[model samples]
Target: MPAMSRSTEAIVRIDSAAKTVFAYLDDHRHLGAHMSASSWMMLGSKMDYEFDAGEARLVGSKFGFHGKILGIAMAAEQVVAIRTSPRLKVWETIGAPNLWVIGRYRMGFEIVPETRWSRLRVFIEYDLPKAAPARWLGLIFANAYARWCTGRMAKDAARYFETAGGQAVPSIG
Candidate 1:
């Protein structure tokens, strides 16, 4: 986040309350669902997660994703920078990231109240990877990855609430 020069954002109107949506997404264990699973966006690569102490449920907490991509190891550590209850949550990558495409980033989600539902905005401000190969590839795929990552988060939340049917959101450890 120190010098993130590019960003991508996606907004979706969810059929759930501001509080409801915030509560759901605030538990970021459920966020980044797309990256934890193999998909076209990830080119069939799946990353494993590790959340430390209280599962990164509050500011100053840490979490990460580590996995091999095309026979090379890649990883990143992220720390929650801000968490305003039932409204906004932001996290940023720490140290150098050994990954492809988008590298270090500040990612966040915000919920806005409406009469009956909520408007959710998911965004990422990022810098391309510093490694030459990854930076070169990033110039081609960074925006696409950002768009897909944000869009997927929004879509995932929407689907979650719809199928949840007002039941309580579950905890993931």
Candidate 2:
């Protein structure tokens, strides 16, 4: 099947420094903390495994979501690759062998420094395969869902920074 791509982005101003925001994003475990509760329900359970990738975090990590369907086990895997600069952090996702939902995914966070805050621009792109009906459904809803999720994540992050005194909190689940 041919592959189709969809992307979405959301921006939010965080009352923190770019370094602090990047630090929060660098940790793979902190990912679920930024997502909405409904999103977490659809994802079922989250499992994360991270390995040392030398200079950067999340460069060689694997995030898995597992759920049950009709008494059968279902799982999805996202292998991560990260590139980091002073102001930009990019996370690229390559579909694992067992998971065929999305072909490729990339999420980038650009932290623009402001006078007393930082503007975080979150960009996410994913490729959907056209071979299966499920993939078609993903294509239809992926963009909107991604946008909603990203917006929620950005807002949650901002709120966390605001209430937690910009401290890096541990990942949830």
Candidate 3:
């Protein structure tokens, strides 16, 4: 069935050992550090308190960040839905001056036991306001952002998994 919303999808295969990818995301604190140039730096709530280990499974869990796009103030919130091994999924709602966009993002990792090579898939669904200007702007730049974020994450994940003791898989295009 059609998504009934705008979307962006990307995938990257990683070579790593069992639980490596899951462990990487399980460390929310360290994950942000690995992200370079993330506009939404304050991804989750509780920077001031202790990390809730169960947060990984909290559906409807939300967090927001204030940022500027093209120098204009914008706000975004993401909700956690799935965060188990082999699959990490979340959804985001973002609002700007006259635009509101919804994004459903997911990443999948498949670990190869002996070779330690893993396959990864990343997908994003971007739903924009049903207005002309909003649709226009989104069509112009949303995919670019998705592509960049996906590529960057893939590269960073590669470096992270390898250096953190997982096997290094040749990056796939």
Candidate 4:
């Protein structure tokens, strides 16, 4: 069915300015490491692979991640898109049929600069199958997963700004 609920407007302000946020997010290795590590554990994905190496300059770049869901083997393909520096970034899934069962996974990010810091805005939109059980499970997991992912991204953004280097962002339990 249609999405039961969507938390598309989560915001977090990081200590770094807008430029730093832009640089960090645009840096493929930085973004990939932070997200890959977090997603691997949370999704129980076996291997997170980056086909881009370090040259992820434009959108449409593709990457794959291997994992299992409920003991069923799975792999996910992600395609980069809509690169808006320090403001907006979007990615769509190109792999994983099981994920398609629920809906398409889309990620959007925006940053607003304040006096000394920047507010990071993230939006996640997924179209769900028009089925009761799937919709129910989507709702249940959506909220919990969004919260988990949001906190992790914010923490990682902060560290990325402060350190000016890539570091593992701790998951917030």
Residue 118: error of model 2 in Å? Answer: 0.4
Candidate lDDT scores, in order, read: 0.86, 0.62, 0.47, 0.61
TM-score of every prediction relative to native: 0.94, 0.72, 0.62, 0.69
Task: TM-score for candidate 4, please give it.
Answer: 0.69
Candidate 4 local Cα displacement, residue 163, angstroms: 5.4
1-173 in candidate 1: lDDT tens per residue? 46689998999888777877877787765897788898877778888989897566789999988998777898999999999878889999999888889888999999888888888999999999888989999999999989999999998998898898645677654
Question: Model 3: which ten-residue window has the lowest total lDDT?
Answer: 41-50
* Model 3 TM-score, 2 decimals: 0.62
- Give the candidate order by descending TM-score: 1, 2, 4, 3
lDDT score at residue 159, model 3, on the 0-100 scale = 68
Q: List CA RMSD, all candidates.
A: 1.3, 4.3, 7.2, 5.8
Question: Where is model 1 more than 4 Å wrong at Cα?
Answer: none
With candidate 4 superimposed using the best TM-score fit, by how many Å does residue 130's alpha carbon deviate from the native?
6.4
Q: Please report, as a residue range, the 10-residue window in candidate 2 with the lowest summed lDDT.
A: 46-55
Residue 148's lDDT within candidate 4 is 59
Better of 1 and 4 by TM-score: 1
Pick the winner on lDDT between candidates 2 and 4: 2
Cα deviation at 125, candidate 2, in Å, is 0.9
Candidate 1 clashing pairs, residues 3+ apart or interchain: none
- Cα misplacement distance, residue 45 of candidate 3 (Å): 20
TM for candidate 1 is 0.94
- Give the per-residue lDDT digits (tens) of candidate 3, residues 1-173: 13535444445555665466656644443333423243452232212212234443355555444444445444444455555554554534433323323233333233333464665554555555467665675667656756655555566676676675664333322
In model 4, the runs with Cα more than 4 Å from the true position are 1-5, 32-35, 38-47, 53-55, 95-97, 100-102, 129-136, 162-173
